[model samples]
Target: MKNYIVILLTLITALVSAQSTRKYSNEFMNIGVDAAALGMSNAVVSHTADVNSGYWNPAGLVHLEDNQLSLMHSSYFANIANYNYIGYGMSLDDRSAVGISLIRFGVDDILDTTQLIDDEGNINYDRISTFSTADYGLTFSYARKLPLDGLNFGVNAKIIRRIIGDFASSWGFGLDAGIQFENNSGWKFGIMARDITTTYNAWSIDEEKFEQISGAVDGQNQELPETTEITIPKLEIGMSKKWIFNYDYSLLAAANLNVRFEENNDIFSTSFASINPALGFEFGYTDLVFLRGGVGNFQNERQIDDSENLTFQPNFGVGFKYKGIQIDYAFTDIGDQSAALYSNVFSLKIDFSIFR
Candidate 1:
C-alpha cells in the first residue's frame, strides 16, 4: 500500500512540475492517431505490447513475449473515417525480435460539389458528387535487448503514402526510435522520438495543377489547384511505476511528456502529458477467463468531467484472456478542442506465442 502511494505521489509531482502552458500544432496534424492510442489518451511508451507498439511505442517491440500476430480495426470520430491495422512480431531467437505493421485511414463517399450557372443569366445546375480518399503506411521495426539485463532499445522506419480519388498520389518516409527499461521492482521508464523527418513532399504535387492556379490560361478540367504539403516533427517521453498489491491485484500508474514543433507556424510549445494513471487487476476466474479494468485522467483544453461518456476525463477499459488469446477495449477522446469528437474508441487485441 505504501509503495502504491509513493508511486502516485511521484507521478503527480512529475505532472505538476512539468506542466507546460504553451500553444501547439495546427488542426490537421494534431488529430492523427490509431484507435488504441486514442483509447488511453495515448498513454503509451512504458506499457508496450500488441501491434499498437508500431504507433505508440516502437521500443515496446522489445517486450514481445511470443511469436504472435495481431489484427485491429477501429472506427474513429463516430465513423467519420475508418482505420485499419495489421501487426506481426516474432522472436527470431532468444536475443532478438522483429515486427511489421501496416496502417490505413480512409474517408469514403465524400460529397464533391460544383456550382455551374448558365450564360442566360440563370442558374443551370448544382453538381453533388462523391469521391473516396485514403492514406496508407507501412512500418518495419527491429528491437534487441542488450545482453546487459534491463536495457532494451528499438527502432522503426516507415513508408507513408497518400491517395486522393485518383487525382494525385504522393509518398514520404519517416523514422522512430525508442529506449526503455524495467526493473524487477516495477519501476519503468522510456523515451521515444517520432517524425524525425518532414513527412510529406511538395515536389509530388501535380505540375498540371500549378499552371491553373498561377492564372496561366489552361483548358477546362486540365488544371487543378496546388497547396503546400505540411508535415511536423513530434517527440514524446514517458515514465511509469507499478506495484504488485498482491498476486491477484496490482496498481499501475504512468505519465508522459510531449514536445511538438511546426515548421510553418514558427511555434514552439509543450503539452505536459495528460498524466495518464490507471489501476488494473487480474483474476483468473476459471483459469480460462481473466478480467481487467481501471481509470485514468486525460489532459485537455477543457475540463473533461466524464470519462465513461467520452466527455474526456479519466479513461476506463476491460480485457479478457482465453487460450493464449487476449482482447481489450477502451473509451477515450481525440481532439483538444470543440471538434465534436466526444466518442469512445473500440480496440481488439489478440496475443499468442509459440516457439518452434
Candidate 2:
C-alpha cells in the first residue's frame, strides 16, 4: 500500500516535469479510448477482468470466468467535432474469443459553399456547387489464448470510409495486433500495433491551392483541375503494464511512443510530431464497483521554456456491474486546439463466459 502512494507521486512528478510531445499521421478521429485510457495508466496488459480484454490485450480473454459481452463509446473534445465508439465481445469457449467494434467521427458542421455573380447594374444570384465532410470506420476482431500460460495474442481489422461532399469520398483499411501477459499476482503487460497498412485512393480535391486560369485567343478553351490522392501511413507500437492488488484494488500506468518515418506540417501530417507518456490509477470496493482517477501527458511540453508549463490533464470515472453487463464512464481532457477545453467519455461492455 505504501509503495502504491510512492508510485503515484513519482508518476505525477515525472508528468509535470517532462516535456510535452505531439504526433501526426493518423485519423478516424482516435475514438479508440477503451484500452486507450488504460494504456494511459499502463495498466491494460495485465488487468484482465472484462470483455474489454478483447480491446486491450486479446490474450486477456483467458481471464474470463464466464462468457461476456461489451460496449464502449467516447466523445473527443477535438476541433468542435464529435467522436464516439461501441464494442462487443464474447468467449467462444474456454480458450478463445471474438468481437466487433464501430467508430464514428462527425467533423463540426461546415458552412456550405456556393459561387455567386451579379451584373454591373442588375442584381442576380446563382448556386454553382455545395459540399461538407465526415469520416467513419468499422472493425472486426478475433482472438484466443494459446496453450502457453504467460503468452496470449489477437488480431483486429478495420475498413474505413471518408466523405467530403462534392470533394472526395475516400476509402482505406488497416489492422491491429495485441498481446497480454497474465501472472498469478495479476501483474499485466500488453502490446498493440495499429495502422500497419492503409492508403486513400478516392480523392480529387485540394482545398489549399488552386491552379491559375489563363485567357486564350479562344476564351472557350479551358483546362480541367488536377487531382491527387492522399496517403495514410502506419502508426506503430504501444505497451502497458498494471498490477491488481489484494482483489478489490488495482494500479495502472502506461506510455505511448509514436513512430515517424516522415516529416509533415499539415494538421494531420506525420512530420512535426513527437512521443509522450502518462500515468493513472484505479480503486474498487468488494469487486462490484470501482472508481478511477489519474492524469496524462507526463512528457508533453516544449523543451526550451521551463517558464511555461501545461497542466497535467486529469481523468476520473466510476464503473458498476448489473448481471453480465459492465458499465463504465470517464472524464478526460479533449485538448483540441479548435474546440472547447473539456470533454467526457462513456463506455459500456457486456461479457459472456463459459467455464469447466
Candidate 3:
C-alpha cells in the first residue's frame, strides 16, 4: 500500500511537470463511450467493474461475476456528431471472461459541394449535394486472473473501418492490452496500452471524380495521392481507493495519467508527452443510487497568466439501478471556445446474473 501511494504521487507530479505535445491520428478512439465512465472523466482504468470496461481496460472484465450488456449514445460536440457504443461480457469460468464491443462515430447530412459559381458568376444551390462520413470498430477481448490471486491480465483485438460517403474508405487493425491489480485493502491499480500495435488507416480517394467536378477551370489543379495514417500508441495509468462507510454507503476516489508516444510538432522527433490528467469521485447510497463528478484535461491551458485555463473541463452525472436494469446520464462542458457546446450522454446496462 505504501508503494502504491508513492507511485501514485510520482505519477501526479510527472503529469503536472511534463510538457504537453501534439496529438495523433484517429482522435475518435480517445472519446469515451459509456456515460458512467465519461461522467467520471474517463478515469475508470482502475475501477472498471461494469461491462463498459471492455472498451477501457479489458483486464477489469475479470472482476465481472455475471453476464452483462451495455449500450450508450451521445450527442457529441453540441450535436455536430453522433457517438454510440455496445458491449457484452460473460464469465467463462471462475477466473476467465470474454467480451465483445462495437463503436460508431458519424456525422450525417453533410453538404457535398461541387461548384460554388458558374462561368456567369451566379450562385446555384441546385448543384450542391450531400453525403455523410462514418467510423466504426469491432473488438474482441479476453481476460483472466493470474497465478497471483489479486492480479489480472487481458488483451483485445480490433478491426477499424472509415468511410467518406462512397468516394473513399479505409480498413485497419490493431491490438490493446492491459493489467490490473487489487487488494482487500480497497486499493486498485491499472495500466492500459491503447493501440499497442499502432493502428493504421489507408485512404483511397476517387481523384478523377473530384478533379472533374471541382478542379480549376484554367487546368491548374493538383492531384490527390493515396495516403496512410498511423495512430500513435497511448499509455494510461490509474489508481483508485474505495472507502466503505458502514454497510449502505461507500465513496470512491480515482486518478489517471495519460501519455502518448508520437512525433513532436517537428514530425521527426518522437517521444512521450503527458497529455492530460483526470480526477474523479463517486458516491453510492444503498447500492441503488449513485452520484459522480470529475475534472479532466488539466494540461491544455490556453493562457499562461489567466490562472484558470479554458481547456480544463468539469463533468457530472447520475445513475440508478433497479433489479437487472441500470440507467445513467452525464453532462460535460467541452466547449472552451463557447458555452453552447456542452454535450449529454446516456447509457443503459443490463445484468443477467439473476437468471443463473
Candidate 4:
C-alpha cells in the first residue's frame, strides 16, 4: 500500500508540475463532496434537492422545503487517506434558503524521515517523527426563487485552507454561482460556474523546515519555489428527465457537460479545449430503495493515450430511506489497476418539515 501511495503521489506531482506557464492549485477542490452525487459520477447538478445540494448546484437548495442535515465520509485510494463532508440547509423564508457545507481531507500519521539515517549510515528508529496533513473548506450558500415559477438562483462563498505537517500552509477564497430551472413535467436544467472569481492560494512556508529539507537532500537547491497558484473558472451545464411508472417506481436519467478555458502556451493564449461529459441514471422503488450507476471522464477519442485507452471509469451506488432518514453508499473506479486507486463512500442524511 505504501508503494502504491508513492506511485500515486508521483503521478499527482507530475500532473501539477506539468508546465510553468500553466500552473494551477488546490485540485482537491474538484473532488465530489456528497456520496450520492459522486455515485452518479457527479451528474447531480440538475436533479439534486437536499442539504448536500449546495455542493452540486446551490440553486437546487431552494427545492428543499424542509430543514436538512447531511454527513459523508470516504476511504480514498484504498484507505491511504480520508475525506469527509457535512452540510446543513434551512429555509429562511418561502422565497429564499441558506446552506452551510464543510469538507475535510487528510492523511494521518505520516512518518517523518529527516532523522532516520545516521551519519555512520545506520538507521535510527527513535529519531523518526510522525505528523498529519490536512485540507479544509467551508462554504456558505444562499438560494432564492425567481419571481417566475420554477426558477432559482444561488451563490456560494468558500474559504479554503491547507496544512502540510505544520511546515507549510495556505489560505484561499473562491466564489461560485448557479441557476436551475424546473417545470411540472419532471424536466430540469441547471448551469453552474465554479471558481468564477478565480480562486487563489497563497502559501506560507516555514523557512527553517525548508532549509532542513534542503540540507537533507544534500543542498540540491538553495531556494524554495513559488507557492502561489490560481484556479481558473469551470462551467457546467446539466439536464435531466424523469419517468414514473405505476406511481410506485421512478427512473431518472441525467447528463452534464463541463467546459473550462485553458492557456495554449501562456496565460494569454486561452481557449476552451477542456471538455468532459458525464452520464448517470437512477431508479427508485416506492421511494424506499434506490439504485444508481454513472459513467464520467469521457474524453475525446483523439486525446486517448496508450495508458488510458484500455481502462474504464464507472461508478455505482445504493441508498435506503426510512422515515426521513437516508443512508447512501457509493463506489468509484479509479482506472489505474497498478495503483489500486478505488474509493468507497458512505453518507447519512436527515430531513424534517419546517412547517411542522
Top candidate when judged by TM-score against the true structure: 4
TM-scores, all models, native as reference:
0.69, 0.67, 0.84, 0.85
For each candidate, what is the lDDT?
A: 0.55, 0.52, 0.79, 0.79
Candidate 4 lDDT over residue span 1-356, tens digit each:
23422443343334333434434777777888777787888988887877987888888888787899999998776687888888999888888899999999999999988779887889989999999999998999999898878888888999999999968999999888888888888789887778776677889999888777778876474687678877766677789998999999999899988765653322122353355678899899999999999987653232245332223368889999988888999988845422236788899998885235
Off by over 4 Å in 4: 1-22, 117-123, 263-271, 300-312, 334-340, 353-356
Runs of candidate 3 with Cα error greater than 4 angstroms are: 1-23, 115-128, 212-220, 223-226, 262-271, 302-310, 334-340, 354-356
What would the TM-score be for candidate 1 when compared with the true structure? 0.69
Per the 3 Å backbone cut-off, how many clashing residue pairs does candidate 4 have? 0
Distance (Å) between predicted and true CA of 142, model 4?
A: 0.5
- Pairs in steric clash, model 3: none
lDDT of 3 at 233: 66
* Candidate 2 residue-wise lDDT, 1-356, digit = tens: 23422443343334323323232323553434463353244334444445665555455655566655555554544546666666666667877777666677766556432233322333334433444566777777777776667667777777777776654566666665666655666455555545434333344553431121122223243454333333333232344455577876655544444333344322223443333334556665655687776554433234486553344555667777666565777766534322225566666665553222
CA deviation > 4 Å runs, candidate 1: 1-37, 115-129, 203-230, 262-313, 333-340, 354-356
Minimal lDDT window, size 10, model 4: 263-272
Q: C-alpha displacement of 17 in model 2, angstroms? A: 31
Q: lDDT: which is higher, 2 or 4? A: 4
Lowest lDDT block of 10, candidate 2: 208-217
